[model samples]
Target: MFNHPQAERKLEIQPNCIGDHVRRETVAAIEVSGDHAARSHIPKITALTLQCRGGYTLEAELGISPNGYAEPDYLGWEVKQYGVRDFVNYLAKSPVTLMTPEPTGGLYREQGVEAFLRRYGYPDKSGKPGRINFGGIYANGRDFHADTGLKLVLEGFDADKGKITNVDGQIALIDRDDVVAASWGFRGVIGHWNRKHAKAVYVPSLMRAPPPEYAYGARVELCEGTDVLLLLGALASGAIYYDPGMKMERADTPAPVTKRRSQFRVRHNDLTTLYQASVHENIDP
Candidate 1:
């Protein structure tokens, strides 16, 4: 069982003390629970632990509710658990999903989702017709989309003007027709990242399973608002690359469109610059 000195305090957590208190309590709870058979899902594990120690219940999923405001979980701390096998040494192997908005302009915006899908959608790994979003390490004046025959030409990334632009002078998905299929503006992506960083408190956990699946909160990572600017700089330097997500098209439409969730992600080791504080080596199970 994990033992922490702070667990004995039982202090009533205030706003300023939330991060440290939550981390300590969460570690203590997981240590007390110990390992068990893999009888419950991950959400069930998180809910049970938080309810037992924090006195608040949360949804079993990893997202904010429609009516609910953002506060990591019920206690205003973001909880993230991952499989132990997925980590390498001290580094975790999980990609953070940055943004997933649809394209904003060009032929993609004009022709609509259906038309864009008809032209760009292809057979996925499962042999089903789907849209595959692609991103790579890009440089200025470099061919970021060589396979797709698309070029990267900067447009609005002026520091003085406070505007950012992608290679095409716009954030977009281009079709073989050379038309902008879908796009996101630099301002849009920046705003989203800013909001994400404001209340972000990362609770990293390691999970293991055999008969009883068990997980433990290993560390907590905190980020400040200034880290957002650092992240933006990383994106510009190609230290962080775009990783797009694929969704199957709905069957009800005459011409179905597979939605792609666009993301900008970096390696686990690279997170040091993006986060302000990291509390590690707290739990061992």
Candidate 2:
């Protein structure tokens, strides 16, 4: 909330609002309908049959794709990883200007976002008597990928202060069954944003293995550090807004670290506003 009539509209342009790119918080908030709910993985695979490759006839019969005999098997695909976005495509196309205003001297001066606003009049209030904080919007969009995905929920702890005994560079999150759970990488930081629906997020530097699709947890271990979920707040800790009615599969990664740490802190937006023809949230003021 700001006094300006256009401030709210500008904030909507941020990642938490609508755009072509994917964001976990936004995805969780959306009421996925029809084929989208059942088949979100189709975006990953396309044109396996018409690729013009010939070899294994048995692959097509056995439901495998050694050659270009059949279409991609969307059902057997892997989980979508983090940072697999086309954001750079948009940034590359954005215009660049030289007469951008330079911040006289302040935190804004170092970041250089003020220059853009002073150079190009923000979508509204042309040359208004104020500085535009463009970095806030940019950072919000970047965080969509920065602190997201299965890894976002992974946690780590201080070696000397926390209960990290194994120190073998990897650990499993499990109950009594001994089933392998979430995996933690070498060194990382688990950050939590200030939000009600937010989850404790793992800001890992290197994440190769992802949690199983629809899995509950993963046996998380790390070389740099580790952290386990607390019993008191465990059940509701990393509670994502996954639909109870949805046919969710058990996740593949481990979860002992964040069993009680909510991963996704989504701010549910009003879908009613989206349907309101006269009330435009993304109005170009």
Candidate 2: clashing residue pairs, number: 38
| Model 2 lDDT per residue over 79-152, tens place | 11111112222111111110111213222234433232233212222443232211111111122222111112
Looking at candidate 1, the ten consecutive residues that score lowest on lDDT are 6-15
lDDT tens per residue, model 1, 178-207: 555556666655565565454444443343
RMSD in Å for all candidates: 8.0, 26.1
Error of 2 at 242 (Å): 9.5
Assess each prediction's global lDDT (C-alpha) against the native: 0.43, 0.20
Clash totals in order: 14, 38
Worst 10 residues of 2 by lDDT: 215-224
Best by lDDT: 1
Error (Å) of candidate 2 at residue 113 is 44
